[model samples]
Target: MSDAVVGQVAVDQLLEVLDLKELGPFRFRGVSPRVGPQRVFGGQVAGQALVAAGRTVDPARLVHSLHGYFVRPGDPTEPIEYQVESIRDGRSFSVRRSVALQGGRTIFFMSASFHRQEEGLDHHAPVPPGVPAPDDVPTMADRLARYPDRAGIWAAIPRPIDVRYVGEPGWVAPGDRPPDPHQRVWMRIDGQLPDDPLLHACALTYASDLTLLDSVLSVHGEVWGPGGVVGASLDHALWFHRTFRADEWFLYDCWSPSASGARGLATGRMFTEEGRHVATAVQEGLLRRVGE
Candidate 1:
């Protein structure tokens, strides 16, 4: 199959996963991809939980911020049930808490707030200076070609996002990448999406998890898997500052602020290709060497 066709198929699958089955009011069900890791991807749970919360809210209100915790590893073979609590609703703001459960155990939970668009003070930080355009960076396929053995299971997974890295990725062999404080990349959905703003936001939520944690590893040129470090996201938070499309190019500029006690914290800012700062994300994860 052509690469474009494969990409579209992957994106369609992602959309299907995000489209949760509404069991009843404030309750929904989501399933993982048939072919994926043994543990569910954290981004999928966060995005699905957001979808559940969004469905119970007023469409006029756009999600402004979300804070989520990964309480336990999710099983990819089973379905997940999401319950959303309507925390509050006011003239201009609404809050919802979403909990994901499997086997009656809470695996993940998130608190998200939505805001009605209104005229108010507006400003955003400028995009980082002297960064290469998305088109100038090497594609994931291009990079993987140089490290075929390292590709491992990732090569079999469908890529719904077209990512172009500005610096070395976390999957690279140790010593291949020089220590760099900043980890930047340009990315966008691999296929076209409908014009629903909520879907766009959810898609960005999924894409956000892909690389934010890599900033922590890049600081010391550490890679994932054996002979390097293994990690799991403990918590994640995001703030949406402006409207943007998931299908268009955006820069994800990330850096690590600290790493201690076997935990690493990373912060990232998203800017449109046109230089509009649209979103920010922060995450801290448990990072430990193999067999530790």
Candidate 2:
């Protein structure tokens, strides 16, 4: 069989693994309900947690920011319990706090804010110049061909989104020189998502965790290997800029400001092809070298 056919097959399988079901208030049960090798894929928890928060909001409003922490590794085999706290309700904004629990233990906690649309002062940092356009980049599947040895990680990537790095290409083979603290990538879902703005926002939150944290590794001259480093996201925070669709191609520009004492901090912004700032994110993670 051709590599393209094989690649497509792999992506289909990944999407199945990520597709989960709503079981209760702010809670979800995975389609398979089995613990993945990482205890839990942080993205799944983040996305479902957002869904839980979204349920409590007025549909006319949109979520503008969500801050969360991974308190403990989740038990993927059991249904996660999400507890939402209504922090405040105002004319223009509403706040909610959600706690994800399993085995009666706190696994993740998040605070999200919703907003009624209104005009405001508008300005932003311009999208940097000299970066390759999304159209010119190779898809993740194309990059996977370089690492026949770690086929599992390649296959683990979901099919609906195409990810291509515009900077810092490594992990399979470390480059002659490491990437700078900053990196950029282009991505978009391969299929159409529902028009529900909340759903699209939650989906974007899921994908946001993809490579934003990895940019921090560049500062240490490290590359993410399938088995080399012990890594996990500790917390995530995102501030939405305005209405946007994640199903369309957007450029994610990432940079790490600091890393110390086994933790690394990174920040990123998602921009539309025309360079509108859609959202911004910050993530801190445990970045310990494995077998140290």
Candidate 3:
């Protein structure tokens, strides 16, 4: 009946979706929430595949990087099977490749590398100047609420991560404004998670895709809507630089360095509340308009 109650329920369901069921030693089963979509979200599959790969590895190794490709749109009506390959185990590093299958066809696959933490040379780029704190921003719901008629679709879906935009969301029309190539948002999981470092990495993987490519659209002043524009991620890569938790708010500063050949590239850096640069990501997507 209350908004808090409804919000809590949605988060509990998201956590359940993240917890994959192991069917065998090297295989896992994951399901997507039936959130009024014919296809499942790509981030969910990536995170699940990473989980499968991490499960096959020893706890001593933490995931430092993963590169994955989206092969096809996932069918939301069925469960996805993840098969992990243990590629190699070195003295200090391990490698694994995970494939997500449905109907006996591979829909997505990823290669992940893990490492045992060790002391080494340490330095990082500082947080960008004049970035507003996450607490001072408006929630997505509040922004969507401003456009009463167009808010229903976004309102009906359940969000596993809370994202606070530093400026206007790219989806909202910015009248008479020139195209901008930068996008910034603060994100955190909807609920608390376990102390597992691998889970944190997977959670960040899921969160990373939320708005990285939107920087591309922002540069063209294109907002996704009926007959407006369409886009899908082709490939994604992430490099973990330091330790961070998914439940705590992290600043994602992103920019579109280039967009040509009908493909746009966007990159992002993740910073912790204490200003530690924890991760970086780059994604290229097929961006085009409807009926083009």
Candidate 4:
């Protein structure tokens, strides 16, 4: 198929995968991990919630920051209701809050802020250390190919995006030694994105949730065993640093600060090729490691 055909198909596929819906004062939909787990992915919830908020905001302003908490596990088979509250509309910025409900209960909640582009003082922390150049690293697709016969989690990962691991260890199974808690990877959509900033931003939101919380799971030599150690995303937040294309290569450097009390925290930063920081993300997940 031609690129246009592929693009069109991708757009439709994303919409179908997200399955967004409109309800009074809210948007409703179902998001799947694509894994067999009965619960939805937290990043999917955050991204979908952003889409819900985006629908209510003006086009002139684009989302720059968001914070969300996943309060309950959402049934993958049931649709999630996203209730959007117009928090504030100002001359320069607007804010919206979204709550994802399932079974008449709040499963996820998010607050997002949008802003019109403006010139102002700009400074960001320098990119962290030890990220491999994109050319030298193996893409996740290449890595997954190493396990062609393996099924389940490997098969569940959606392939709309390309990911290159900077320092990936224990990706397939537990290693001889304990796995490291920190990792670095680069990612982007496999195809080009349109010039529309809104679509690009939404795509970024969709891609941001991938592999975020799993960085924590890698550290403890804990493999995401099939039907074992039930895990779910608990909360996610992201800050857009500047305008950037989601189709271009961006580094996703991830690390886990702590994991305790059945929860683990993972943080990630996205950077452009020239080392400019584009976004930052944080996620906390319920890591109920089976057999304690």
- In order of listing, the candidates' clash counts read 0, 1, 0, 0
Minimal lDDT window, size 10, model 4: 1-10
Q: Quote the lDDT for 99 in model 4.
A: 89
Report the lDDT tens digits of candidate 1 across residue range 1-292.
1233247888999999999999998999999987778799999999999999999989999999999999999999999999999999999999999999999999999999999999989888789999999888998888878787776556777788898899998888997978999999999999999898899999999999999999999999999987899999999999999999999999999999999999999999999999999999999999999999
Sort by lDDT, top down from the best:
1, 3, 2, 4
Error of 2 at 92 (Å): 1.2
TM-score of each: 0.97, 0.87, 0.94, 0.84
Q: Ten consecutive residues with minimal summed lDDT in candidate 1?
A: 1-10
- What ranges in model 3 sit over 4 Å off? 1-8, 174-178
Question: What are the lDDT scores of the predictions, listed in order?
Answer: 0.93, 0.75, 0.85, 0.73
> How accurate locally is residue 26 in candidate 2, as Cα lDDT from 0 to 100?
47
Query: How good is model 2 by TM-score?
Result: 0.87
The better-scoring model by TM-score among 3 and 4 is 3
Candidate 2 lDDT, tens digit per residue, 1-292?
Answer: 1133223443344345445456665455443223234466787778777877888789988999999999998765667777777889899998998788887888888999999999889999998778788889976766667555544444553345677888655354455336577878897766666687887787788778888876887666576664445678999999999788877889999889988998889999999888899999999999867676
Model 2 regions more than 4 Å off: 1-37, 150-152, 175-177, 226-228
lDDT measured at residue 50 in model 3 versus the true structure, 0 to 100 = 91
lDDT of 1 at 243: 95
* Alpha-carbon deviation at 270 in model 1, angstroms: 0.3
By lDDT, the better pick of 2 and 3 is: 3
lDDT of 4 at 86: 92
- Which pairs in model 3 have colliding backbones? none
